[model samples]
Target: MTAQIENTGPLTTEAGAPVADNQNSETAGSGGPVLVQDQLLLEKLAHFNRERIPERVVHARGAGAYGTFTVTADVTKYTRAKFLSEIGKETEVFLRFSTVAGNLGAADAVRDPRGFAVKFYTEEGNYDLVGNNTPVFFIKDAIKFPDFIHTQKRDPYTGSQEADNVWDFWSLSPESTHQVTWLFGDRGIPASYRHMDGFGSHTFQWNNEAGEVFWVKYHFKTDQGIKCLTQDEADVLAGKDPDSHQRDLRESIERGDYPSWTVGVQIMPAAEAANYRFNPFDLTKVWPHADYPVIEIGKLELNRNPQNIFAEVEQSIFSPHHFVPGIGPSPDKMLQGRLFAYGDAHRYRVGINADQLPVNRPHATEARSHGRDGFMYDGRHGGAKNYEPNSFGGPNETGRALWQPVPVAGTTGDIPAPSHAEDNDFVQAGNLYRLMTEEEKGRLIDNLAGFIAKVSRDDIVKRAIENFRQADEDYGRRLEAAVKALRG
Candidate 1:
């Protein structure tokens, strides 16, 4: 038999030339200062200085894995996306799970919403489904995003998170009522990344080959079941092992205990949006199952752990703008803003050629565009025409017709306004409150009161109580009582 080949190679500089010595810098004379002409030392130090990219403003702490998504049902009548067109079709995917408001070293078990973003490598292109653990978000409009995130972060003066800061913003923004209730509930602190559910959170549009359009919402229910930590349990985990979630995910995968989720979608006919009880595009609400039942589509299973955290996880970028054919955006204000924000943030943090990074690169199809010449450009388009409408046989557009646009009859301006007549903010929140069990409602009240009681400002506390009152009388009364008792 032929000798087994070993691919061991010598170390070299980034320029690919073999290095003579890596352990020492060039010196002027024996025991003298290092020489400035040492190109290897200069190059090594320069690269080390820039080895780290800017961390994400949010979702900074994350863990990722490689997986496969297999379609179990056919929904071709609603969408023409090739990846979901046939049962048994499989798409390779990279999924990143993160804590939304945490830093790179923050405790994973802290009470916070988790990010569940997936990059699907399909024949059409890469489709990124960037979502969160919670089905509803804190605010509906993108204008409130920065301010809202600020509240979730540290106080400028104190350099630490203050209850006053968080409560003041939430109380002032009544749209936050629905999500606040969810946040303080048991689901706020997931037991592990494998045990929580994931949602698209925003309504999306799906178009069939016949040109029929339908509104859609995605839900990934964890096969491991919904498990959450009590405040006491989470606090203990935070102190004992801040990286508990990351360790659990990595160890489980290594032990061959892969986690999985059932993929389902709630689809609404395009024309019915006009007459729907609530705005279909509202990120703060969910489509009631009575009206639109979930249709089972596929399953997502994470079977492999990433070999390199920075290369496969940190450099991977997911954006709402990344979509395959027949799958498009909706009028959700938050989603609309994210289509631009996510990509822009990636470019700024990871470099203009972020898409060329191995983890973020498209595996199924080559990306074609007129864009060229940026930092770390990778020089892939050798001798290819860089512009459209050229005599040279460059890549041409598909010439496909655009999706049908919904009619718009409102005055357009920079100011944000309600999208529908029934856009009352408190109704769905009240409905959600009433849907919970007695024990859960009690826990929610206790959680909210405990957090709000820490706010020094009475006015903020009262304003927050009023918003809760609008959601449900019992909810507000219990919270008010709980806060008073805590103060006593």
Candidate 2:
């Protein structure tokens, strides 16, 4: 008798255990219907049913692409970040564009803040620049964040966003006036994500090998040029084709006409930040180009579309905390809050092993750590020591690899930053008002009043006009007139 050879493919199973039956399920008989007690069948169905996790709380509607970031100019003097060290070294990157204040099912063309986040797979590690198109944000402190977001989201009672509720909050919180103006202006509704600029809204820190630190703000200017839709046009598009932006991105990549952007940074010396005219750490303000000019650093291009939207895009995680060797966080309160909140949210939504997912996995270097399996961790570290300080050879700590230490000079307590003369939020916002041309100012007032008039309370509208009045007398007067006209 010939020796029977059993065929065995790579040993695999539902969870990598070897399976005995390939086709048949546990049953009463060979010809009988499958039994509920079939462990394999139950495992398969259970896994499939719970495959998807909760979507993002915000920026839920988004798309992603793979690309390369090439250093176009020398920026090594300011940052020791390896990706920007070489003049022409190309670093692999994954970029995602999203709309804030919209649910996963919401329209893409809505008047919302477009999230322009990028994850660079650098040799050091994955560095995430989680940002938005605009340079400024709505609120400065993390305390007001939930309230601010509530205004943008749907009404808790009606399940629909009410302009009255939105304007009510904005009027009460005058600090939001700056970002609110940007939201209703010509660039409010971007024609598509490709045609808008992306900014590292919060100032970040860059440290060189010399241990010299500089505050930096990133500006990714789209090569496609800035394009925006009129309010009427955006409204029609939102109703006509809600998925217009998402479709445009997918179609453009499929045709091989990749979108590109020039990455630039406005660098400020650390010593100068304390004496700058405006509060540099404030998230609701912008550092003017006249004081600190933007210097080009590199170029970002998106050429590859994701094969699986769910696994590649939906599960793809990005956080401001994911910094490489040289880049570090600033004193910006919003950025500090996000450094904790984002990673925490990802852990809750995607699990601790989310970094192992194909989309979020580091491509430039091996993710060597003592971290073992949590929920879905599948022995990524094979035969490797799972503890540090082991006599056996393992990853060792490098003290010199640490980033530049920022000077902290206040009593260590649960109190806020000491309020300086520049603590008032209205100054820079007023400066932005005065900078606008006559026509631009007119449009600004009209837009502000148009949105504010929707608030049912005249007293609240008056309060909002007073806040604008504090910025510029003429600005407040014009807005007041417009609101009155809106009421009439």
Candidate 3:
């Protein structure tokens, strides 16, 4: 049946009083100066002036959509998360795709890692799978995160990203080799948000109903098939249309060509983590697919574009720490750091009451917390018990709130140490280099040389080459030759 439009009586003010003269302001006489009593004119100007919030420190440029995640395979044996309990169970989701290092106005086609963050508004709670396009990060420790981001951003002196600053940090940090290789490869410049893969880069713990724990990594393989722009195509697009990715996503959804991903997870038995070939919790590394094959779990489809970009996308926040009952954090230092940093950044960027916002609020369940008044709070828990541990019975703690006990053996200290088997930073990087096909290896060499040639410091170039040399002699030689040619 075709639905007819029902007309609302008239436009009204925030107080629900009918606005008689919305177009004109009150005045002492006709054509006279506007009067101070014009509340409509005053309110419009005031609200317009305060409309913008501070742009995100990173992942500032993004596009978002409303979607549904349906479980295709039962994952209850691995995770007790209610959303994954039964096949065909659907959970509402919001996904925001972004370019990591870019500002709000930066081009979408730049050679950079993309942010792939998803919020699952489940019956239990909001579960945020905050991740990136790549499976590994540039650093394993959260302590280096700020420094690494600084290198990716503008140089303090020039107000522009400097090649020297970027390579200097990466060269000194051998652990960055794996991610650097990925960043300079074909996948770095994704053709659009629809075609690239998404990953929960950090290994996460999934507790089953049986009280057993398994480590898992999430992978969202794009059903559109992997597509990327070469350096030339990306350069041209950057100049032609900076908002290409955003427009592509919006228009595709509007035309009913919805994009989807096949959700899969690589699960490792908790006991095997101790004896794994590489540190299972290392953020800079990946658990080889051969060792732990990804089990198909679900499908995520984006069918609706957001109505308000600022309210739904810009204000949306995702934190790795926001986990439900079955999901928990691993010992990855980067993930641990993010558990605090992401939430703190959101509080500063979007205000403390961000969760109460419509875009962030859980749809299937009402949030019950003793969190009282804060800026922009919706006052949902009015006149309720403000403090916990009270006899008044506010929100009681659940038995599931307790995290599964993880064995701890390392001494608490700030010293930099490699504590796991095959933890040497260069081994995995070398293995990745060897895994690339001949054509890919050639492109990787050219990409590294192209950027390294712009770095003015010879010592930094030499140091970077040394790291590559340790990875593979042929890889180092080809890069060195290419850099020398470009330099000459």
Candidate 4:
């Protein structure tokens, strides 16, 4: 539905403010090299100088592709979201997949959670589903976010990742047990980007036109099927080809072997969620399938490779807060924190009009806002009245276009945050450990020991083992034994 490139006139400053000269820097005198007081030269130089923003602290390395999402099953009863309203409607989408806890230069084959974020350009606007391969996270509360990220990042003293630092945080914050189990599992190191499930780990709210709200968790089941690399294979791949996952994604799309997933949602009614056994809004947990079964919604196919990696993929922005009319966020604390953090980061990195970037812009809807003339304004809203209540017609807010409001009732006072009922964070982890076959459990223990054994401090290693013991005695004992064997 896109038109060919039309003559948009000569390129100018980001604001469409015309520029007569940009090739040479202005100078005090023609013989003089340059002058600092030239505003135009300063604007161009300053912007060009600060063009690159800080890469994500985590999930820094990634690849993206353009695609379309086709509604294959009716989900109109659950969500009024147009992308899933009909059985045949198609919406343009862009999907970005990346590894978390790794730098931009890190190897793609490393054992870490893969971020699977998708931005759908629906008629309503952009809906960004920011998620990961795992269905759960390490922490529940937003308050612990910075401290938690610190452990995964480099050590302040050594300037490198330290097993002791990570374990110290994990053992202390017992809530991380569930996600830790998944991290050590075979799924942690996927063989390729194509062979893994993507989940909206946070429970979100889907509001119907009737104002009914449901707590929803999205699962994009890979049609390529789940495939994982063993530790040995992962190590070999890391050494042989650091960008294995990125290369795989680009090549697949280029060759027309498009990677696709069937979108499914596990939804819980709002009333039931109020009294559910577990905290429905907790990011570090999942709703059991028996309680809320998977409902198929649509299919997402990545059909087009990005023309320019830096312009289209590296600078692209995705956030959990970018919701359209039918979708809204839940009271999920971590999700709430990210709503602010992601947008704030984009503003810092790509400037105020990051949304104007072609990769981030909506496909069908024109952006209308009081915000004008930022670093990268695309001039799409040219000559249109920028202000509301204008003599000349300008875009106005539509009440019917608004999302169905979910009631927000709570005392405005400082209070202890809500915790999940029966919140023994280790139980589900123990269950996961028990479900693993003996061989799998052995590998898990070995993997834990492989990393933990690197810690120089004996106390740190013992403390980490104790944390595992809290989950399962056998788990702790095996890890301790493996560590000792590795030391020998």
Query: Who wins the TM-score comparison?
Result: 1
Candidate 1 residue pairs in clash (backbone atoms < 3 Å): none
Q: Go through the candidates in order and give the clash count of each.
A: 0, 0, 0, 0
Per-residue lDDT of 74-172 in model 4, one digit per residue for the tens?
Answer: 778778887778899999999999998888889999888999999999898899999999999998888888998899889899899888889888878
Kindly report which residue stretches of model 2 are placed more than 4 angstroms away from their true locations once superposed. Answer: 1-48, 413-423, 437-439
Better of 2 and 3 by lDDT: 3
lDDT of each candidate versus the true structure: 0.91, 0.85, 0.91, 0.86
Q: Model 1, range 294-337, lDDT digits (tens) per residue?
A: 88899999998888899889898999999888899998999999
lDDT (C-alpha) at residue 154 in model 2: 84
lDDT of 4 at 64: 90
What's the distance in Å from true for residue 311, model 1? 1.3
Clashing residue pairs in candidate 4 are: none
Name the weakest run of 10 consecutive residues (lDDT summed) in model 2: 416-425
lDDT of 1 at 196: 100
lDDT of 4: 0.86
Deviation of model 3 at 434, angstroms? 2.1
Relative to the true structure, candidate 1 has a C-alpha RMSD (angstroms) of: 2.8
Q: List model 3 lDDT by residue over 1-488, tens digit each.
A: 12356887998888888899977889989989999889988988998999988898889999999999999998888888999999999999999999989898899999999999999999998999999999999999899989999998988899999999999999999999989989998898999999999999999999988889999999999999999998889999999999999999999998899999999999998999988988899888888899999999999999998887899999999988889988999988899999999999999999999988999988899899888787998778878888877788677877565246789886888956355777777777789889899999988898889999999999999999989888888888999999999999
